[model samples]
Structures are given as structure tokens and as C-alpha cells.
Target: MTEERVVGLLERLLQAKVGHDVARLIEKRLGRKLEPFDIWYDGFKARSGLDERRLDAMVRERFPTTDAFQQNLPAILEALGFDRDTARFLAAHIEVDPARGAGHAWGPVMRGGKAHLRTRVPKGGMDYKGFNIAMHELGHTVEQVFSLYRVENTLMAGVPNNAFTEGFAFVFQARDLDVLGAGGADPERDACRTLDAFWSAREIAGVALVDIGVWHWMLEHPDASPAQLREAAVKIATDVWNRHFAPFMGVKDSPILAIYSHMISYPLYLSHYPLGFIVAYQVEDYFRSHPLAENMERMCRQGRLTPDLWMKRAVGSPVSADPMIRGAERAVKSLLKH
Candidate 1:
């Protein structure tokens, strides 16, 4: 998609209903004006209601080490919607290990090889944070296994791009609390989730714009030095931050957006995250009446279809953020009334 089209699509979340309502909800929850650090806000998350220490204890009790998590993959997959046979088959094709750093997934190229999952497991045990990251990585592992082994042609073995994979990661990560049996369904909980998705998507949209802006700047000033590029990056970040985030946050000219290493290392990859979040929301909504594992198998096997066609085939609609915005609008209004 073109940068303008992507930007325009994401900016819808920043309008009167979704973004502003999230700010209001945050203000009410915190009983204070938004701080710069509020960009990492967690109050919208259901787990925010639970003590972190308790969650850590629970996770450690369940997964005292990486091996424990690896062994339980079948059960975990079953809990997430896969039947026992499918869960066991998926688990059989995946291996897990401890990570010194953050969690990640690596898939093998050939059919006989396995998908590898890595997550941090401390001397003490795997805690809530590590488990959450592991769940995210598990999504990637599952997608890899399906797209690689299940597809007819190994050459067409992945989704549209990294954004689609990230979307899959988000799908599993969003269910971590539920997988632990620590989450329940209710109107407010559902509302909070809707708001959470909107806030997070809106949060990344500005950073994506800043990334796009800096790329355009670099192209126009091809001969610029590192110092000049850095300065231009800061200016572009400030412009994006002011236009998108400052008003809602009541914080002005924050250069936090400019500091992401993705600008230097991955360059232009930040846009994938917001788009991924949009894709995740759409997928989650599609699962309301549809069975996830059935559709997941059906969709992941579609191989290299374009994202629009892939989404339309899988969910009966093209990938877009309108469903999330509408849900967030309904959620915020309902919560406000209550």
C-alpha cells in the first residue's frame, strides 16, 4: 500500500471518537494529565487489574523452566482452540529453548526440519513477561509451521510480509491471559480490549509516519551526513508527534518517536507494526462466530496470496482498521455511559 493510503487509514483512529476517548479513559483511570511515559500505558490491559508479582508466581508455578513450557505446548495449543490431535501435531513439529535476551521464533526451511521457539527463563523460572513474549513467539512458530509444511509449494511459504506475521504474533499474544485461565468474558472486559487495540494501533501510527517522513527526507538529501540526518529525523518526529499525539497526550514536541533504532537498522519497517495491529484486530473479530484453528489452517495454507485477497478469502473482508475503530467507538461510549 502507498504511504498516504496507510497513513490515512491509521489516522482514522486518532479522530474524535477513538483516540480522544482513549485519552479520556486514561485520564479518568489515572486521575492525572497524561505524562510522556504514558505512551506505554497499561491501565487498559486486563492484567493491570492483577498484581504482577502474583502473575509471575503463577507463571513460574506452571512453567518453572523452558522445558516445562516446551512440554506443555500441546495443552496450550488445545486451550487456544486447536483440537487435541492438531495441537499434538503442531507441538511435535516445534522445539523450544531458553533465551538470554528477549523471545523469538525461527523456522526451518525444509519439511523434515522443525520450528524453534525461544523465550527467557530465568534461574528462578519463567515469569509473566517471558511467558507473554513466548506466547507471541509461539504464534510465529505456528504460522511458520503451517506456511512451510502445509503449503503445496515450499517457494510460496510465507504470508504477504512481516506485517502479516506480526499480525499472527499479536493474535496469540492477545490471548496469553486467557490461556492462563486468568481472564473472563464480560461487557467491560470486552470494551477494555477494544479500547486497548485502538490505543496501541494509534500509538504506533505516529511512529510509522515519522519513519516514512525520515525516509523521504533521506531520499531528498542523499548527500547529508549522519548529524544532518539525525537532526532531520528529530524534526520529522516532532512534526508527526505534534500532529498526532501531542493534543491527546497534553505533551508537546516529544522526540521519543525519533529514537527508535528501527529507523536505522530496519528502515521503514515501523509501518508494519500499526498495520499488523489492524490485521490482528480484524482477525480476532472474524473469530467471533468462526472457528480459529479451522480458519487459521485454511488461511495460512493459502501461501503467497496478496494480503487483500488472503484476508478476503479468510475473513470475507479486506484488511482494514474500520472494525477496530467502530468497536472502540462503541466500547468507549458504553463505558462512558456506565
Candidate 2:
């Protein structure tokens, strides 16, 4: 079958898996009654502005599916401005595994000298969610690579916590299209980014609220059953959904909370997404004015830095919601202004 046909098939599969509500909402927005095939086809093609042939080529070129990630690691590292020795050190330690459900970075102070990565995402997972996961893993890998090879000592060679690293990962993940030289900046691409940014920011912000509430609930009801946890999660999720998303959806349900996979594995990771969004945009803005290489290396080298210190050093200010909120607002305004 042709690549477009494959992409279409994947999209249909995705829509089928996600549920009718999401599919219908997307269909309406796209100005048609949506079919499963349209989910992947329309959504992917819309954001990327690339047909199957080009998208496949781009993906293959960038996401190395084998041991050869070693070869690419140096270029990526060097692009972010690592020194030659540091780049080589990172290249030797970049491990690509096929064992993970998605992707991950296990590195920086483990007994092993190298960082291991797993890239076993489900098929058709190449959509925005999958890509975001991929880029976030890339962010983690880069941090691992930098801290292990470039930092002064093992003690300091890593991020202080998962959220801070996730913040960096979020920053890199947002740049996936830009890094790949895909469609961006023009009217079509800007519209795509705006829609995605809106969708992502809204979805994640709600999840963050749910996560916070769930944690507090968990703390209070330490012996809460899985069912109780799930029930409480649904209530919290519905609350956030009603406040933020009900206007857009015209419906409310707690099943939405059940859909967040991270809620099961990483209880607190949801909060990091929104925080990462803020940090990513802040870093993105900084990279706009400063050279990507010099600034990024300096930022990475300051391993395990406090969030406040890291933000000040990298973005010339403390971490705040202003960057993401303002950037998103401006993106919307620009689209409306046009």
C-alpha cells in the first residue's frame, strides 16, 4: 500500500482506539463527519503539511531505529554546542533499546557509564502524542548524555528531579517540527501549532489539576483502594474538565480522567507536563535571542540546578506562567488578528 494509505489506516485505528467523543469533536472541527481513517490522515497531514512520502522520509532520517543512534548522537550534541570530547563521550554512551512501552532515559548516575533508551512505541503512535513522547525522551537522553560526559563530577551530573528534567524535555519536544525542518511559521503551520498548543496546554493543565487533587486525596486516604483512587480521580478530572473544557465539548464525563495512562505509572508526572510547557516556552524564547549552541550547552552543563537558578541562568528570569500563558495568548491573538 502507499504511504498515504498507511497513514490513513493508522489514523482510523487511532480514532477507533480513542473513543467516539474525541473523534467526533475532531471531525466537527475539521468540517466533516469524521471516519477513523480521517483521524490520523487529517490530523497528521494538517499539522505537518507533509504527505506520507515526505513524512516517512523525515521520520526515518531523524529517528534512527537501530544501534546507529551512536553516529547521530554526536551531531545532535554538537548542534546543541557540546565540545568535541564531550560529544564523543556522549556518542559512545547512547544506548537504544526496544524494551520500553514508549521511550525513556535511564542515566546520569546509575552504575553504568552509559544511558539506555527504549523506543518501542506502538504502531501508528507517530501522531502528536507519540511525537511528543519521542521528543521528551530525546530531552531526557540529551540531559543524560550531557551530565554523564560533561559535568565535573558524578554527584552533580544530573537534574535535581524528574520535573526539572521533564521541563527540559518538554522544551525540546516542542521543537520537534522546527528541528526536523517541517512546516512551521507560515499561516498553515502557525494555525497547526496554535491549535496543537491550545489543545495541549488545555488538556495538560486540566490533568495537572487532577494530579494535584488525586495526590492530596491519596495523602488523606492513604489506604484508598484502586477503585477509590480511580473514583476520586474521576471527580477531580470532571471538575477541571467542566471548568476548562466543557465550553468546547458541551459534555462532561469522568472517563476522561481514566484515560491518562501516566496516572497509573507516574502519579505526579501530569503536573510536570504543564510545568514543562511553561519552561519549554521560556527556553524557546531564550533560544530565539541567544545562539542555540552556546546557550543550550551552558544550560545543560549546569546540572541539578535549582529550578529557579536554572530558569534565571537559561531564560534570564525565574520560572513563571507568563511565558507559556503569554506565548499562547499571543499565538491565539495573532490567528484572530489575521
Worst lDDT 10-window in candidate 1: 9-18
Predict model 2's lDDT versus the native.
Answer: 0.59
Off by over 4 Å in 2: 1-29, 32-47, 61-65, 77-86, 110-112, 120-135, 177-191, 223-226, 247-249, 252-255
Task: Rate residue 321 of model 2 by lDDT.
Answer: 55
Give each model a TM-score: 0.95, 0.73
Question: Residue 39 of model 2: what lDDT?
Answer: 18
- Strongest candidate by TM-score: 1
lDDT tens string, model 1, 1-338?
Answer: 66676777677656545677788789888999998667778777767767889999989999998899999999999999999988998999999978889898998888999999989999889999898999999999999999988898999998887878898899899889888988777678778777877888887887888888999999999999999999999999888888888888989989888878797789889989989988888888898789888788888999878888888998999888888888888988878877
List, residue by residue over 21-80, the lDDT tens digit for candidate 2: 343446656787533223133351244555656655566655544444445667655655
At residue 89, give the lDDT of candidate 1. Answer: 86
For residue 25, give model 1's deviation from the true position in Å: 1.6
- What lDDT does model 1 reach? 0.86
Error of 2 at 235 (Å): 2.1
